[model samples]
Target chain A: MAFDLTLLTGSGFWNPFFWLISIVVALILIYIIYAFGEKGYKRGTQQVKPFISGNPEPSKAGVHVRAGNLYWGYMDALKVYYAGLVPIHSGILTDYLLWLFSVAAILFVLVVLL
Target chain B: MITDFLLHHTPALLVAVPLLGAFLTPIIGRISPIVRKIWVMGTMTLTSAIAVLLVYLVYTRGTFVYVFGALTPGLAIPPDSGGIPIRIIFTVDPMGAFMDLIVAVVGFCVILYSLSGDEKRTGLHYFYTLFLLLITSVLGMVSTGDLFNFFVFIEISSLASAGLVAFSVEQGRAVEAGLKYFMISTMGGIFLLFAIGILYGQYNALNIAMIAERMQFTSLDKIALVLMVVALAMKCGAVPLHFWTPDAYSLAPSTITAMLVVVSQASLYGLFRFVFTLYNLTLNYVTIGWVIIILGVLSMVIGVTMAIPQKDVKRLMAYHAVSQTGYMLLGVGVGLAVLGNQAALDTYGFIAIEGGLFHIINHALYKGLLFLTAGAIIYRIGTRDLNKMGGLGHSMKYTMIFFMIGALAIAGIPPFNGFASKLLIYESVYLFNPLLAIIAMVVSILTLASFVKVFHSIFMGPTLPEYSKVREAPPAMLIGMGILAVLIIAFGFFPQLVVDSLVAPAAHALINQGSYISAILGGA
Candidate 1:
């Protein structure tokens, strides 16, 4: 019943106990770091003021980013790719069927040829 | 003695109990809504118990064939038949039992969640009935040994799920989604039937084992294989043919959406069954395997990319579901590619296949939990739009915690169930080809990034003035999420226990197709 997949060289990921021990050791290290950190900070004071290159702080609602605006750079870089791919998911029934038929045809040809 | 009786009749009872409950739901609803709720929960609990027992029986006793209407379960083929199985048989192998276990556990949790989550909707009786029937169809699809029976169950599940998808008629988009789902499923069903006809014409058999035993691997068989694989992959939401997935998944009622995830996994189970058991290594393993691998890669990349720009929470999660499916396909595809090479298989191929099998269960648990959490949020907030919500963590603390758990689990963070299986795939698949493993790791990072976006938009930031009065989801919904949450933690911590008892055995059953064919034809 012991399911162990021994990888190359005798090391493997079969023992959950190893993971448990690692987790405990990591937690202890984190606790030690937290204990050594600065404390006695006060909220709602100039000391805790927001810093943004010395610019005035914006309203909370305005600063909260929306999901659509979060990944702008990634989307912009992949613009051409999205232009080709997004239209395929055009939410049309005919396009869906067309894709199914096209994939079937391609797979059939590949299987037969190979 | 009672265990013997139940074990003997497990296959029939697995399908029958839900079917009977489905029919009786409307009648019981007239008596009292409370009675109806109790009835649905009681039925699913009973069915879940039976599924566990069936998996136990299959794992302990090996593969057994239960022939319908026969005096004994072992009489799969007629004595006078010329080595052909004429009777419809229910083949309970380890793989089938594993799928049954998934359907049972997820289906039961969904039913429990719906009790409170859907309490205010009209036509409660019909909803419960279709839900039960959906469960029955999924169970039938996985357990049946006959190809034609599998088709019948596929149709039933398709219709039931489409009906549930359209349940929210108030949203015109739901109706549109249901229509698209029905049309796609109808096309899939037709192709499935045509493939079955081709096999029946060539081998004169509808039983999967019979056709597999007599397979000639002719040109016609090649055509059938293409048709079957494409149709099942389309049904399971593989990219290029997965347009129906996001629409159907996003539009369905949340509980039903959870069930739809399981439905897609069932179709995936069918795809693997056909490839590994029916075709075995007879076909061009490298070509077909690469085809699957390429499909997996596209799904993984495109699924995550599409999810990034989505504003609707459910639609975003739907896309992630597709991406997660790619991992399963990738792991198993690598296994298939090296199927005929015993040296490669012994070294890393079986591990890859186990990784895929392990991901199947993990995906079902985490994805199902995520959907239920989305439902709980929508129940309180009245909107699935991410931009309109913030700071739900203040009022709905438990829901926030559950969502965090599901989010972490789905993103493949360590110590969760997703990480264990994914780690197996990433390590072992590098041996096959480093690029595939690299792409998989990149997809994992993207998945985590997307979920972080979701967590920040919905649960972080200042509390929205509109949702200040929003309360936590009801106890029943919390209970449903709790079941999956506890399981996620258990499977995460005890990965070896699950791999040993379930995934490894299931992977072995899939690779060893000789035993499957011999079990049916050995007696004859």
Candidate 2:
């Protein structure tokens, strides 16, 4: 047996229940588009210069926002995330020893118990 | 089935076909470029087809083993007790076949991609030769019944992968990255050898099943197991040990880089094998699980944070590779933590492990697609800088579409494959520990933000003045991305299919580790 089609798409077309719902959905989509286009037409010609209250929007060209500028607010909120991770230094010999110790402790407990 | 000829030989051929092709490729290449290309594609396709066939056979006939040199089990047909099977073997019992499928599918796509890109100057033939050898080694590592063979295959994969990393000899940074890769991998290899030495001394047997039978969880074995875990962790690019990954991944050609990500994932398979097979933590899972979970959390937090600041898109993806791996570990770790807790194991443990394994498949799909798309961008615009890319959505519309799909998938947005797997992980792990799940959710959101940055910088904004003349990626690259995109959407919508066929078998193999051992030893 191949695909039942009903399970994939819906029940048979004349099943009436879903057919009604489908028509209603299609009508609503068209209505929404029509309503949105009408409103857009009104707004499109209202002669509004780019509204400049105080801070103007940047030019739509050539500005590549760096990570610092992009997340300045968040950066300010979390000032010292690196402090917690500093011990994970790539160059630290002691950090290596600590990792070894932790791994050892965990394995020792597992071997004893399991 | 026992009487069938072809079925009996399929397991051994899975490894042998590619191993033979790896050597045969160079000889064919000397005849003509077309010959080598055709042969390479043919051999990979055949291997992939065989993988599919083997999976089908397993589904039908159950678990099977292929003793090397035709070492028949028992006195007559099936091997009996005390019958010293001197031959090496290939055993496929669900998990091995699944990993084979991953390697073949991903490797095939990568080979197809290499055909599309500009061939490197030095030894294109050797590149494909090593490429096939790498595929063979990965398959062998996943399928070998013997532990020593696993190490041999690892060395093969490591050497071929390093050579591929430095395949572009003109680029000095590629050479440097390859050297770094070799150093770190060799350290991992040494550690692996040390563990093997300890295990061999203890059991006097190298077959995985034989070793598992004799292993008694002694203090020495415990120390060796921990060392093995650490070694495999480094190989898998776990946090704090993942520094070599980003540089090596960024330096290689994108196709090779994508393959390298999957290669690291194979190490996770090794870890899974050890955790479940070598050391069944059905009794004492909490402490071990907590250790893995904590490492996963650290990796999740650190990898994405590092990615956020990376300028090179490949390096950024490489870091995300590390981060996504943390997500997988979180799922598997949560599962491990609650294994013996009957109520927890059935509900949360299974869900978390399944989620993690599902993410493994999903990561290979979207991440592979993303790296390929990044390569497409570089191939077209000739740069890896996210800053220099702007309004690429207009010039490289196809690439943009594919990149957006991959980005959305990786970010764990709903209606994408990433979200489905991640949602499973979140719910299951939340049951295990809500704080861990919340941290995972935060990492998901951060991943979304990072990909959004990528999209805005590369696809939106004005076209860079210099790149106004840039073209879309070649058709073959788009085909590669298109295949992954389809898979991403398909799996997202009908996830139960993947869960049933792929994830269930893999998780089952992990849980039923005894089945793995017994199957290799000619039992179940």
Q: For each candidate, what's the DockQ?
A: 0.43, 0.13
**lDDT (tens digit, per residue) of candidate 2 on B261-369:** 8888888888878777777753357877876787789789898887876679998999999999999889999888887787888877888898888898899889998
Largest DockQ belongs to which candidate? 1
In candidate 2, clashing pairs total 5
Best by lDDT: 1
lDDT of each structure? 0.90, 0.77
- Fnat values, one per model, are 0.50, 0.07
Best by TM-score: 1
* Weakest 10 consecutive residues of candidate 2 chain A by summed lDDT: A5-14
* Candidate 1's TM-score: 0.95
DockQ of 2: 0.13
Q: State which docking tier applies to candidate 2.
A: incorrect
Off by over 4 Å in 1: A1-11, A14-60
Q: Report the C-alpha lDDT of model 1 over B305-418, residue by residue, as the tens digit.
A: 889888999999999999998999999999999999999888889999999999999999999999999999999998999988788888889988999889988888867888
Candidate 2 regions off by >4 Å? Answer: A1-69, A83-114, B1-6, B71-85, B118-121, B522-524
